[model samples]
Target chain A: MVAPVFDSGSFRDPDGHVFFYENEIYRTLTTDAVHRMERLLKLSFVKKSIIEGRIIDTKILEATKIFPKDFLVTEYVLWHEKIPYVTYPFEWTFSMLKDAAYLMLDLLSGLLENNFILKDGTAWNICFYNGKPCFYDILSIDTYVEGQPWEGFSQFLQEFLYPLMIQSYQGIDFQPLWRSTLAGIPAKLCYKSLSRSSLFKKGVFKYVYLQEKLSSNKTISEATLKHEFTHNAFSKKALTNLIKNLRLCLETLTVKSDQSVWKNYDSKNSYEEQDVKEKEKFVVEGLKALNPLSVMDLGCNTGRYSLIAADIAPVISCDLDPTCVDQIYLKKNSKILPVVLNLMTPTSSMGWHLNERKDIFTRVKSDSFMALALMHHLCISHNVPLSHFILLLRSIASKGIVEWVDKSDPMVQFLLRNRKDIFKEYTWENFQHLIREHFHIEKTLPLNNGVRQIMLLSEKKN
Target chain B: MNVLMYCLPLMATSTPCCAYLDAGSSSMLLQLLFGGVAGGLVFLKIYFRRLVSFFKAKK
Candidate 1:
């Protein structure tokens, strides 16, 4: 029997911590939180959310069936459905973040109708499962007070609204902002990016400008404000109105993207339709043979290959450009989770002790992977060595499908158009030699009149 | 339900545990003022006051 390992990432919650035992996810709820958990089990909306896969399915573990009985024996134990791949807000694209924000708002609104409300408004509470945002923090729900305004309102603004707002108004991607400040962006920080004229924007005056002025007041203390808030006759209608208004504002917000080079690589690549079909056939056959539980599509442009791999198993489709990831997310394809990832600078271990949020490497370890039409970009464009690129693939997955665009290819020539080709080892002979160092070459498929070669490989035994 | 429908006076109740997160005094106050048209009017007055002060301070 495997020992139960506590998830350091879930330590922030006072109610309980999540743990894994024998590959099963479990949550130990403190008695203080049990009432809410009990209520959630009976709620129609919560049941519907679980059925629709919006919320992770959970079940109360009986006292007799509890594993690691000595640990948290006093606390009420609950079993939770495990997410195949865990991702942070910083790894998400604009549409992914927007969808997560909406999921929280809509869930909170529905919970409020059932006399319960989500106490925490952090994006950390939601994770994408198969390209759709799903809330997993069951402990966040608490009894909705009759006249109390949403206590999570300010948190929602900082964590979701402000980050999203800056992206919409200034066209600045929120990934860098989220990476820098995990606690969500302050309204003042968001205010700085936006033009002075942007204050007149729909939610600007109310959510941003007004909130900034009010929060800047050092005269009133948060405790005193809470005291005053409790004294004031705030109504449920007012709270609902606020959520409704926020929904309207957030729904309209969108990031206007630039003409990214890699965003439309799949559609605009020089590869012919027949070559593409042959490549797809190779990837599918490779995936079928590997029979891996999960597949990671590195440089998954528009998730074309990810869609084909998704037919075989769950895929973690990744691309540097938010637009490409957003397109994959828009497809809402089952078994495919699209993440915005820059291969050169993948997300790092961060937060307190750097364990609170698992880095990209730790989170994205898969059984197999596909790096289709991506070699030229990584080695040729980004200056990453072909050996280093293959090493990265070998570290994350046991087997994968890698495509090599020859130096004579049009795209390769385009990448080398302005820069001098100092790369002596970017040849087929070196690729085979280097890749064999880490991975055993299983089969190779040629595409686009032999200009591109796709190889399926498995990790060589240690 | 429209605002014309009798706006019932609700007695504020305290739920200390509900606010483990520091919701910020001014932010909650602003949210209260952003309830509806009446709330918007109240915030508008505050906004204009701040705008006037901002210009005067700049000068």
Candidate 2:
């Protein structure tokens, strides 16, 4: 077995750090954390959660086998089931974050029934596995003390509740705000940004406005509240009611499904029925031949092709429009993950040493990808060179399909209307030459009276 | 600050401090208010629709 490498993103939690060894993910727990796990594991609720796949399945590792003698005796070792792909809150659609919030609240409510509580409510630990939200942090659960407040209350507000509120109430996308700061929308900032009229919105007055006012009012000494709560401890029933109230508040929130340019692209894209059939046929053939472990459909407008790829392998369908991506979840397809991702402005590696949170490029776990109708926008509109575009494709997947749109194509013409045509390298010959430099074109199919072509490609080893 | 302090009337009482996470004083204190019989019940009225939906799902 290879030496275990510590995961850079796992420094915040004191209980343990996650690491990778032998292609599997593992966690090293402090002895105290192991005791918490032991207590929780004995509960039928926790075991049932693992069986139902709401929590990531974990098992204590036998000390005699994997780790060296010294390391095993001191720190407890555990193996966690690895998720197929990891996506952050920034790339999530409104529905994705809402679903994650629901999962966290439900888990907390259920844990409290077993005399346990989640210590923290950070949004980072829940991941979408098979299009369902799954909580992965094992050490977050601990015995709930009587009269102690939900310790992660502010964190829940910052990470999940406040962000969703701003989006649903103000018609603003919270992704930009969340992407900028790890803590999510601050209560003060969120309250100030919200309109005074929104003070009447459901749960807004207390959860956001009141919470902000309360946090800033300084006179409410938290130390004093700590002492009082001990004397006037709340029953577990009351705490459960608080959780239910939060859950109910979140369920009422909604994001407007309007404001989408690509929401109806499948019908409005001007592709003839026969042309679409030809395109679908080409994608299916390529996927069948390669039979990749998974496929990522970049710029999957309304998930037309992602639905096709889902028939073959689990597909991560991504687009810049939340409305477009949200349609995938509405379809209720278990094989597809919908994410609101903008390729041109994908998030950079952030936090300490730029490794605490992984960059977009590294987290995409796909062996093959489909970039249908995406090249023209990246090259003509975004001004990325064809060489660099192909380079990105090769870096993302060993084999893939690229739909090359000619400069004369109507969509490309629309993108170039009344603008300086500085794309000298956008010609088919240049695209073919550039692609050939890095990849071997295995197959090609024409569409739309030869205005567009789909090429199956495999990266060439240097 | 004194004016606002008079209005809010801080502290239901003190509870033990929590773990590593910054449980922000206001958020922590609000829980005392929420855990009261009248408070969570009032909040539930705002989310009454959710209560309705929960029943619908059970059916």
Candidate 3:
């Protein structure tokens, strides 16, 4: 009764790994994925893709009532559920990776109309639970072997169509190139970063210049690739016309939003619609007196008080404008997760034993925080000093609400036009004496245009 | 160049395939032969425009 740990990113799927125990989330599997999870749970289209939340519901557990001596040569287990804050796909937002590449091509054209397929199209096997994009690898579906061509088509063109065709024909921002590659933006580095009139558009010369000339054609012919996997046979109307021309080339991918500086910050702010309804009634009364089960927000520009502190809870919003986190991830609010960080450069800890991917303040921490209008873009356009921005907002949240804005406000004199207000301790009594040396302020208000204020705080008991 | 001299004499007379079919299975067999002939000519122009709207609804 004590050995189930595993999950360091579920050890690259050898048909099943994920662990956890005593906090649940299981998985085990492997006797060659128990006949493809019992023919994908006797498919009634996997219970109508788990009642159309596009799969990820899973159940079967009893591996000797939970790992009896580590799944005694395991053959099934499963469980799952978890997902409340496991973001990646480089913290999404570009229509959350175009709604996780149209939910992995609508679950690979609904598991190729039932005879199953997806054996790996990894955008880390898709996540975003409540704000949609589901597909949590139920052993990455399998069965469809006949003329095995769609073996997850070049991992869905290097993780979801060349990172949504290089952010829709190079408007760039595929989150710092999927946070420096986790095997995504490749197709010959998105055909050496497009533009020759975006390689003549429309399904960009058959999915990226004929899949980058058949991936650099090394004289292809191993008996014409073993006669294309034993005398080619595709026909299910040619794999449903190759899943309707890959859903009309992912519905002609789009992007556009460029000139950003917070994409017209809420119709050029200076507030006053009774100062945005008194700053949305003081951030919905300090998120209803901190009933926080997770909140973050921080400069969430187009997420207007992170959709009023996501009606009191799951928020995470953040923003240093990737067009205001692609307009709050095109508001498909599964209680707002948004992203595109930047609190003066955030996402750090990075790859292989540098704690294999974690930092963005150790994957977004929050017991409540909101910051709004973000302290004059972190004290005068990022020179960050008000007591190291109140100790990085008291290491992001132990209850907060912040705001501030002064240096004679018109957006803090438009972040001190042509800079040089060497922020003589940017006053408001030196930001209330450097945020009362780590928080405890509890309510201050101000809005009907008294040049900005807010407050709330808390974390003092030390 | 004449399709790279006709694929280098069919890759020097074929027969060396299964290394777990790479280059993502030859670009998914050229995206299933060009997305199955442009999805069979858009599935025959969507059932030839629903068979000419069923002969203009039987006249």
Selected candidate, larger TM-score, 1 vs 2: 2
TM-score of chain A of each: 0.94, 0.95, 0.38
Model no. 3, DockQ = 0.14
Candidate 3, residues A60-146: lDDT per residue as tens digits? 665875556644436567887877666678667667777787778777777777878887777778877777778887887888866
lDDT of 1 by residue, A1-462 (tens): 334588988887788888887788888788877777887889899999999989999987664566554554435677899988888888888788888888988998899899998887888899988668889988888898776677778888988898888888887777877789887788778888889988889888778865665565433222343443354556677788878888999888887766356666777889888887788788888989889998989888888888888889988889888878888888889788888899888888888898888788888778888888789988998888888988888888878888888999998999899999988889988998999998889999888877889999987997
TM-score of each: 0.88, 0.89, 0.38
Candidate 1 vs candidate 3, TM-score winner = 1
Regions of candidate 1 where Cα sits further than 4 Å from its true position: A1-4, A220-223, A257-259, B1-23, B36-59
The TM-score between candidate 1 and the true structure equals: 0.88
lDDT of 2 at A175: 88
Please give me the DockQ of candidate 2 compared with the native complex: 0.17
TM-score of chain B of 2: 0.25
Model 2 stretches astray by more than 4 angstroms: A1-3, A70-75, A221-223, B1-23, B37-59
Candidate 1, residue B41: the lDDT equals: 40
Tens-place lDDT per residue, model 2, B1-59, is 32232224232222323342233666765675566643333233323554586799999
Residue A105 shift from truth in candidate 1, angstroms? 1.3
Window of ten residues with lowest summed lDDT in model 2 chain A: A216-225
User: DockQ, in order, for the candidates?
Assistant: 0.20, 0.17, 0.14
